[model samples]
Target: MKVIDLRSDTVTTPTEAMRKAMYDAEVGDDNAHEDPTVNHLEDLVCALLGKEAAILTASGTMSNLVAALAHTNRGDEVIMGSKAHMFWNEAGGVSTLGGVQVQLVPNDKGGRIDPADVEAAIRPDDVHAPRTSLVCLENTHNQCNGSVLTNEDMKAVADVAHAHGLPVHVDGARIFNAAVALEMPAHELCKDVDDVGFCLSKGLSAPVGSMLCGSADFIEEARRWRKIVGGSMRQAGVIAAAGVVAVETMIDRMVEDHAHARRLAEGLSHIPGINVDPDDFQTNIVFVGVDPNTGSTEEFTDRMKEEGVLTAYRGGGRFRLVTHREVGAEDIDTAVDRIAKVASEMRNAR
Candidate 1:
């Protein structure tokens, strides 16, 4: 039996070059800002995102925490979409650690947050209200079926934040996918925002690391927060070597993953018990719902596990299967057959 794992892009294996780079990488203490490879990777990421500087973090969650702590003071508010990765997925680090309030605004299906909602969320000049200091947005929003927030939409929301004297932060974990889908450069997507954190470990296929990027002043603050969070490391360039390879080689190959996602989403639509909208999907992540009357998410997911496919399940009976460097067109075709069979069995049982 062959196993196909479509759970998330996080499941991807590092490229051979990435592995070789890790072995062949130059090393030094990075906590002291002395690792040559890490410095090179940071410079590359800063240029890629068009920011004045960048800091490498251990994970996307750490990247967000660093950004949050840097951009806001205690008891301040960070405005963002309800479905944003930091707001929903992270374990309340900002609120729990920094006393920063997360003011979640409604997210449109297309990954755009309404500018008016942002304006409404900002607090007035009252001593009692928590100051809205930052606005966060996601590129190819995770829960929105990888919907790309357009540059125009981003500028609209950014204008609202800028007018209110709020800095904008973008959780760009899947930003490369957004750039590829739009046929534009990644920096173009980050141009309107004040800062962004793009993951090297996801579609880029690095073994570990994400970059927190912004103006030099902002990065200085984030660096302090990184130290506070214990994200500061020495000789991290060993792993950063893979990250360098990811940025250099992995970005342009993401178009194939997006294509596989489209193919999988189309195939899932043909299964009777699954629910999805092809038009709403734009990147590597696909969300499909199992009919409650037919089967629950656990039942469907567990059954698929038996058939050698895996995915992440969530509330509302939805499951996500993401395509990445490891999962290909043939993998898509095989998973479609497995999913169709599972859906049919569950439908027949009903």
Candidate 2:
């Protein structure tokens, strides 16, 4: 049986080119900031994001945590989307470790917080409330079918946050994917924001790593947080090498993954119990609502997995099918057919 893993883009395997680059990497004590390859990756991230400096981290979560810690002091506050991964997925490290208060604003269906809402969330400096120090946003929002936020859309939030002397941090884990969908430069999407972080592992097909980019002073501070969190890696150039190659070659190919996601969305939309708007399938994630009239979400997911179409069940009768370098459009089509047949048979038997 052919297995198509669409659980997430994180499931993607590194390309042969990426592997070759990793094999040839010159690794050293990155903990001391002396690893040449790691330095190069950071430089690449800075150049790509139009930032003054960058620091490589183990994962997007660590990058986000470091960015948050750097942006806010203990007892500070952050404004973010209620649906963002930082709020729902991450282990709440920002609050537990930094003693930062998270003020969440409701996210619209498009996976964006209104600028007006963000403005209202900022606290007044009366010594009564935790100072609002940061505003964070996610691109290709995982919880919302990988919605792409336009540069203007981001600027609106940035404008509101900056007006109150708050720094904006974009959790751009899938920044390249958003850039491709919007037909704009990835840097442009995040340039207006005060700080940004992006994952090299996802869509880029790198084995591991993410980078936090910002002003030189901010990166200096973030480095201290990196060490405190034990994220300071030694001889990490081997991983950074792959990230460099991912930035150089892997970005443009994400369009193919987007196509595959769209293909899967289209197929799911035709099924009676799977409610998905194929047109909203941007980037590489397809979100489908499973109707209980046919079968429970659990039953649908289990059946699909049994048929070798591996995916994840998002809550509220929603399921996520992500496209990646490891899987292609044909795989999407096959998974869709298998799912439709299983769903049809399951409903008939019921």
Estimate, for each residue in 83-201, the C-alpha lDDT of model 2 and write its tens digit. 99999888999999999989999998778899999998989988788899999999979897799988888999999988888899989999999999998887887888888889999
Worst 10 residues of 1 by lDDT: 312-321
Q: Estimate the lDDT of model 2.
A: 0.89
Candidate 1 whole-model C-alpha lDDT, 0 to 1:
0.90
Output the lDDT of residue 293, model 1: 78
In order, the Cα lDDT scores of the candidates are 0.90, 0.89
Give the lDDT of residue 178 in candidate 2. Answer: 94
- Every model's TM-score: 0.98, 0.98
Off by over 4 Å in 1: none
lDDT (tens digit, per residue) of candidate 1 on 1-350: 78999988998889899999999999899888899999999999988888999999999999989999998899898999988888878999989988998898999887789999999999998989988899999998998888898888889999999998889999899888999999998888779889989899999999899999999999988988999999999899999999999999989999999899999999888888889777768889999988897789998999999999999846678989899988778889999999899989988887
* Residue 189 CA displacement from its true place in model 2, Å: 1.7
The most accurate candidate by lDDT is 1
